[model samples]
Target chain A: MSAVAYYLESAGIATTGISLVRENTKALRPPRFLWVTFPLGRPLGLPGDAAFQRRVVLAALALLDAPSGPVLEDYPEDVPDLPGDDVFACPVRFPPRASGRGRWGSALLEEIALLRPWYALSRERRGRTTVGVAGTLVETLAERLGALLDAPERLPGTLAELTELKRTLADLRAFHEEAVTAQPGDPPWREVRRLLWRESVLGDAMLTLRDRFDASGDPRLRAFTRVLVPRGALED
Target chain B: MVRLSDLPDYEREHLLDKNLGPLGPPAWVPPGTPLRERRVALVTTAGLHRRSDSAFDLTDASYRVLPGDLGAADLVMSHSSVNFDRSGFAEDVNLVFPIDRFRELAEDDVIGGLASNHFSFMGAGLLPEAYEASARDLARILHRDGVDTAFLTPV
Candidate 1:
């Protein structure tokens, strides 16, 4: 987005932007940017709050009048609280296996179970699905991931290995969420994304792997760790 | 109320430095006149596209055109980022793409009339080159639409 803003400004179009990730906006230092504390996907704050959303829009647009270059302002108003505070209750918590080695095979199965009904409803409505992109079944994905977790020594070492590991993780996320794209009256999308990031069995398993590799002192591994797994933080 | 302190330090550092390196200096075009007299457009990096358009590829740097007057019902978000819950956006398009807000602003002549068309791109970890081109193209659209100011929202 900083890049897009720069491009627009370079082309003689004055640009002002709202940024969810303040870091990215600060680093890029676009001509004009407003850092908002809203959730990632919902840059304008919660749904059904058109007034708030409009206020956000106006705030961003107001940056256009700044006379100088590289202006960064923080949105003054804090986002109003959600209906419920951040208890983050959900049915998809993943339990580690009996061995407790980050292998949640049964938990994966449980997630698949919890997601199936919603998956079916989504398919009925859209006549399609977001899963199956990796061209593998859910069980197969579980088994393959289990194999990887089963052998910590065989964890990704090279760039290609790390790339493959990340790809596999992507497949897992897609398969799971496309498996259940919240029914019309279901929870908000950001909540689902947050839950998946915070508590998915596979996600936690991957985090364990990331911690293991982050200790390897390999720069690439460290970088991949940040990508595949945050430093155990749920960020916007 | 949301506060910067609510975000953990690591996430702050992560955002402060995405490893993309310094983006170098941007070409600055000063707002020559009062914004109320200028033509404008609204664009987003929220991965929004029309229901009639193909969904954006997860890492796609390409952009899609959104008619300024298109119904919000016709828009949908197909994002690939893992940072936020999309449930709110899935329910309300205005959370990211505030076309309705822009339209209202236009109706009130708060700034200026909107461009003939707007734009969207799936923007997480986007390739600079691709988005550079996308921006160049967006500039053309802005030019054709006689737009002088563009408001962007990143999700």
Candidate 2:
């Protein structure tokens, strides 16, 4: 972000940015930035709160008025946790993974089938979705992912293959999260993430896939698989 | 939150260890227009592009131009990193893009106006040098459109 700011400022366009990572921002200090303490994905803090979001915007833009060199101011507040944010009990529970090879395909298909209604309801209620990034049908994505898991030797380890895998995983995660969060209560994002990575069958399958990648003897595959599960999720 | 200390040790260490490339001397440009008179445009590193646009790849330094009039439903995130939360953006595009909020500001005269076009880039898997050419090119476009101020956001 600071780099972009630097480029623009050098081009004679005034720039101010919302810095999520203060350490990095401080390292490459731009003309001006407001270091926000919000979560990584959310630079403007809360999701639906318009007033709070405006405050953040104004604060960052306010930096433009500062007569200084690389001003790095901090936003004063954190996003308040929502009600029932700490508690997450997934509405639909899948049976444990079957103790056999090639079961992930069928198990994932069944889980998707089970969650279909909720996913549909989520789309209907929210009027939008973040599940099409992979540009694949949810069932098709499950099958492809399962196919790869069933045979690690099939991994091409090519850029296109890696791109497809990443998109597939992103879309899959979005689908499950949307489906689960749409059921009954308002589950905070943190809990939904925990539910996806720590407790779900999908999570188990991903971890298994990571292990397969590790065993594939491909350094690139191993490196890429590190991002499949977040840090601390395995520990939890 | 992104306070380094608030993050898990591994994540914090990874971010801190990232090479930010060589830092050049800071360049300070005075605000050309007052807050209520500046034509502000959004330059995001959130990997947001229109649905009809090409999705971003791991090493893509190219940027997509988002029309200021584009609706929230039409915008989609193709960021390669799964480490950050997407639910916020899913629920409200304004969380990351803030187009609606910017529009409201323009309506209320909190800011002068918004640019006709905004820019989006994929921010992972590459160094800042990769973005230099594209950033300078986009700066020309912004300058051509009379955008004196750029509001940058990250995902």
The global C-alpha lDDT for each of the candidates, from Candidate 1 onward, is: 0.68, 0.82
Q: Per-residue lDDT for B74-124 in model 1, tens only?
A: 665555555655455545667777777777888888877889898988776
Error of 2 at A171 (Å): 1.1
Please give the range of 10 consecutive residues that has the lowest summed lDDT in model 2 chain A.
A94-103
Question: Candidate 2 DockQ category?
Answer: medium
- Show where candidate 1 strays beyond 4 Å: A21-29, A65-71, A85-107, A119-199, A208-222, A234-236, B1-6, B18-41, B47-81, B84-87, B103-134
Candidate 1, A66-86: lDDT as tens digits: 878788898987766554524
Q: Is model 1 an incorrect, acceptable, medium or high docking prediction?
A: acceptable
Candidate 2 ranges beyond 4 A from true positions: A85-87, A98-100, A183-186, B19-22
For candidate 2, the per-residue lDDT at A44 reads 85
Worst 10 residues of 1 chain B by lDDT: B14-23
Please name the candidate that would achieve the greatest lDDT relative to the true structure: 2
lDDT of 2 by residue, A101-200 (tens): 6677788888888888988998888788877777879899999888877664677569789888888887888889888877544357777777777777
C-alpha TM-scores of all predictions: 0.68, 0.95
